[model samples]
Target: MTEKKDSPSFEETLSELDAIVSEMENGDLPLEVALGKFERGVALSRLGQQSLEQAEQKVKILVNEQGENQLHTLPENEQP
Candidate 1:
């Protein structure tokens, strides 16, 4: 019987992406491994970005305008 591995949470993916960047920047990994890590990092980055975008669509940040809180829609997929 094979056991299924659980997917990492968003925070975990972000953390892994950060580690990958650090490892690549440190210039320690061999070319092949570095390339593999870069590819994985790109996928993880896209996943993280998509997750953030979905969450943003659900939540609205209220802005203070004319002394009143107004619903302010964030620019789509614009990272802070």
Candidate 2:
């Protein structure tokens, strides 16, 4: 089995990002605090996007005009 990462999972990151959005939308935080949360949310968004892209790449299947399906890993350069 693969070793677990120390970082938060994509789901958890999204949950935190949602909480930040809810808090910011309430319009109660001080400017500095809201700014900090906004930055964190942006970082989390990027992380989530990257995770999605990686997942998409991993599951890719190629079909040629002949209708044969090819299963393969990403090219060496694209591997994480």
Candidate 3:
């Protein structure tokens, strides 16, 4: 799991992952360092996937009403 103390946003994580991948491709980092970067990249990818899934779930699927497709508003969640 990634550390929460300096948690990065989805975009930032993706950018970092891209950099790590590019670096790994260059074959400059040692085997151990490359492996570590690979692990971090995997974790970042999972986090990005999760964020996308959550956003998708929030979207309301369009419905056909009276032969016209209409988009519904997002449901309001109960506040704590």
Candidate 4:
């Protein structure tokens, strides 16, 4: 049994998902094992999606200020 870890890194989750895909594609695993892998893959996919959404929310672009570019923070509800 694999021990569950708290808050696995995005890369780790992605790698696990890829491995699950490969295993399923091979078509040699027992139904129980395959179903378990599929379930874990779904969980990892959800976590990855959430991580991406959070990153998108926090994304920012830096502009050079030498000429006239200015930095500003927008309200969360006003983000474009």
Candidate 5:
């Protein structure tokens, strides 16, 4: 089979995570299947977190000529 692309986008990963949670909560999956789903969910969570962190690092904050505070790229450690 052809290689798949890199990990899903943040929004897509989050959607998959939500689906996994709903599936787990429904209590219908076999033990093995549930475990697999849980593992995949964890991976997706990590991907989402990493994406957010990268975006944050690229963020910038600036003050306009009018002396109003404006948000540019966000710092990795600080929220916009």
Candidate 6:
């Protein structure tokens, strides 16, 4: 069987996006280079959004396990 390649975790994606933003913000890259980085940033942003949406859906499911619509807020210490 061929091994499956895993995508980067949400945190890793955000970290890479942050690095790209910092590099672009330095204002030293040529136009072509900046455009390439911008395109990558846009793709990473979309991936981050999808990750967030998936996490939100999971939270909703766990919170409403019994079919109740109420969402109980977890304690600050319990937050990841």
Candidate 5, residue 55: CA error in Å? 0.7
Better of 1 and 2 by lDDT: 2
- Better TM-score candidate (1, 3): 1
Residue range 23-76, candidate 3, lDDT tens digits: 999998989998999999999999889877766544533234345455555657
> What is the number of backbone collisions in each predicted candidate, taken in the order shown?
0, 0, 0, 0, 5, 0
Candidate 6: deviation at residue 69, Å?
0.8
Specify the highest-TM-score model's number.
6
Worst 10 residues of 4 by lDDT: 59-68
Q: How many backbone clashes does candidate 6 have?
A: 0
Cand. 3 TM to true fold: 0.65
lDDT (Cα, 0-100) at 48 in candidate 3: 87
Candidate 2, residues 1-80, lDDT tens digits: the string is 24258767889989999999999999999999999999999999998998887776555533344465665679999999
TM-score of each: 0.66, 0.70, 0.65, 0.67, 0.68, 0.78
Ranking by lDDT: 6, 2, 5, 4, 1, 3
lDDT (10s digit) by residue, model 1, range 1-80: 22235756689989999999999999989999999999999999998887787666444332243454555558889847
By summed lDDT, the worst window of 10 consecutive residues in model 6 runs over 1-10
lDDT of each: 0.79, 0.83, 0.77, 0.81, 0.81, 0.88
Return the candidate ranking by TM-score, descending: 6, 2, 5, 4, 1, 3
Query: Model 6 over residues 14-57: C-alpha lDDT tens digits?
Result: 99999999999999999999999999999999989988988888
lDDT of 3 at 68: 43
Alpha carbon deviation, residue 46, candidate 3 (Å): 0.3
Evaluated at residue 25, the lDDT of candidate 4 is: 99
Task: Name the regions of candidate 6 deviating beyond 4 angstroms.
Answer: 1-4, 72-80
Q: Tens digit of lDDT per residue, candidate 5, span 1-80?
A: 22248768788999999999999999999999999999999999998898887775445222344465665567888964
lDDT score, candidate 4, position 40: 96
